[model samples]
Target: MAGKSGRRSENRFIRYLILFTWALFCLMPILWFLSIGLRPRIEIITPQPIYWPSFSLDAWKMIWQDWPMAKYLFNSVAAIFGSVLIDLVLAIPAAYALSRFTFRGRDDIAFYILSTRMMAPAIVAIPIFFLFRNLGLLDTIYALMLVYAAINLSIVTWIIRSYMLDIPKELEDAARTDGAGDLRILWEIIIPAVLPGIITAAVIAMIFAINEFLFTLLIASTPNAYTMSVALANFTGGSDGVIYNAIALVSFIAMVPVFIVVLAIQKHLSRGLTMGAVKG
Candidate 1:
């Protein structure tokens, strides 16, 4: 009994050590970035860095006053929200159809939808650019929002459909017997049942839209439509040269919204991801 107790304690110690190491690995960059953002340029550029650097808010001030940070942040929020809304509005019905209906070529259509994601964005970027340009939609937030929605539509449909399949048909059938149409059944029955999966899909879509760089860079030409990602990229080269501290501050600020969103919906995220893994 003593030997067994010793083995269990050793196992616990090893497990905790592994978890601590992994946490450090994940947190080290964020801590370093925060440290940089708080330090002055003099301390940041020194060959022998200060471990506990003196704090400064100059970077935050520079970003707020000089950079169009507010506009970029607003654009990022608007674009991501629009994309997620469009994705859900379109995906829910398509996913419901895919899940509940049995028409000819259904499998083929599903495969085709999923196949769109396999194409790299670069492969289609030029065509999309020209298409937007021809439509006189270049350099607009609407264009970016539409592109993001289309890009994420396939994955959202697939995820929501999987979750919808896990829902019992009996509930839908009972609703149908109560004189409910397909739309009513979906609105009343399936939507409530699969809401977690919808939330998961929306969160994933939001993250993708938020971090998207190439499309935004290629499409938006003015500050009016520039997102946080594009604003961060502009710091790469400037007339005054790159300021590492300022860049770090911008990076930290850019991540705040996504962090808040993940924290808010984490419970739903966990259940949503696993709920569709196995069908009932």
Candidate 2:
């Protein structure tokens, strides 16, 4: 009995140590970015490698001074929020029909929509660029917003459809028997039940929109419509070459909103992701 108990204790300690080390491995880059962002640019490139150099705010100050950080931030915010709005508006009706109603070729339609995501973004980029240019919307915020919405709508539909399937059909039938219309039932019964899933979908869409680089860089004509990701890449390029400390600072600031949003909606996110694992 003593030998068995001793072995179990050692095993538990080893498991915890392994988990902690993995977490540290993931977080070390983020910590290094923060460290560099607070250090002077000269110390960052020191031959001896100054790990604990004296802290300074020079990098962050230079980043704000050299670029229109506020304009880029505003454009990114508009694109993400606008994309989420369009997605949610369209997804509700599409998911409802897919889950609750019987229609001709419904399954085929759903599969076709999902398959769009399988196509490589690179393949569509050139055509989309030409189309946007012809429409005279190049470098426009609305154009990027619409493109982001279309790109992310497939995942949103899939998620909401899964949640909608879990809602009881009897509830909708009960409302209909009481003379309730389709819109009334959808607003009162179906929507409330699937609110958690909707919130999760919106957050995921927002994150993808904010992180999108290739489309924004290709489609946007000027810095006025640029996103933070493009700005970060530009900071490290051109005749001036890379500025490691400034890049670190911008990267850190760019990541803060995503981190806060994920933390804020953690419970809803967990529920949405684990909706079908066990019978609810």
Candidate 3:
């Protein structure tokens, strides 16, 4: 018994160590970005990466001052929110239905939705471009929003449905017994029970929407509607078609919102991710 206990303890320690190492590896690039962003532009582009900061915000200031940073930021905000809103409005009820009831062709319907994600955005970009052009949405924030929503809808629905399934049907049934209707049950009971999951899905969807580049590139024709991901690409162009320091600075700016959200809600994300890994 003593030996078994010792082995278990050793295994736990080893597992923790492995996890810690993996986390550090994942975070290394982010830390490097921070370090680079803070350093002098000259120091950042040196043959060797500077371990210490020269302690300057010049690159960041220059990026904000020289570029339409505000416009890019606004575009990103608009795109992320619009996409998330569309996804949630459509996905919540769909997820609830899929989770709470059985109906004809249910698995087929779910599979159809999931299968949309398998299509590459690049493959469909030209058609979307033409479609948006005909709708008079070309070079507009709305076009970016629509494309992002369409692409992200499948993921949001799939994720939310899994979380919905983890919620006990008995709870909703009890609400129904007490005179609650479907809408009431969803609004008051089911939604609250799965709020964490909803938040997790929203955050993930928002992150993906914010970071999306290809669709943004194809759809947005003007700087007014261009997202940071697109704007960042502009930094690497010229006869000298690559400003290494500016790239670092722009990249850093782009990652801040995503990093903060992920760090803040990481626990919820972990829980939501595990929601449907097992049957109740």
| TM per prediction | 0.91, 0.89, 0.85
All candidates' lDDT scores? 0.90, 0.88, 0.84
Model 2, span 90-189: residue lDDT tens: 9988999899999899999989889998999999999999999999899988888989999999989988888899888999999999999999998989
After superposing candidate 1 on the true structure, give the runs of residues whose Cα lies further than 4 Å from its correct spot. Answer: 1-21, 278-280
Question: Please, what's the RMSD in Å of model 3?
Answer: 3.5
Decreasing lDDT order of the candidates? 1, 2, 3
Off by over 4 Å in 3: 1-25, 48-53, 278-280
Candidate numbers, best TM-score first, in rank order: 1, 2, 3
Per-residue CA lDDT of model 1 for 1-280, tens digit only, reads 9999999999999999999999999999888888998888778778995767899988888889988899999888888889899999999999999989999999899989999999989999999999999999898889989999999999999989989888988999899999999999999899999999999999989888888999999999999789999998777796967788988988888888888988998999898888777655
Q: Looking at model 3, report the run of 10 residues with the lowest lDDT sum.
A: 44-53
How well does model 1 score by local distance difference test?
Answer: 0.90
RMSD of each: 2.4, 2.9, 3.5
Report how far residue 14 has shifted in candidate 3, in Å. 10
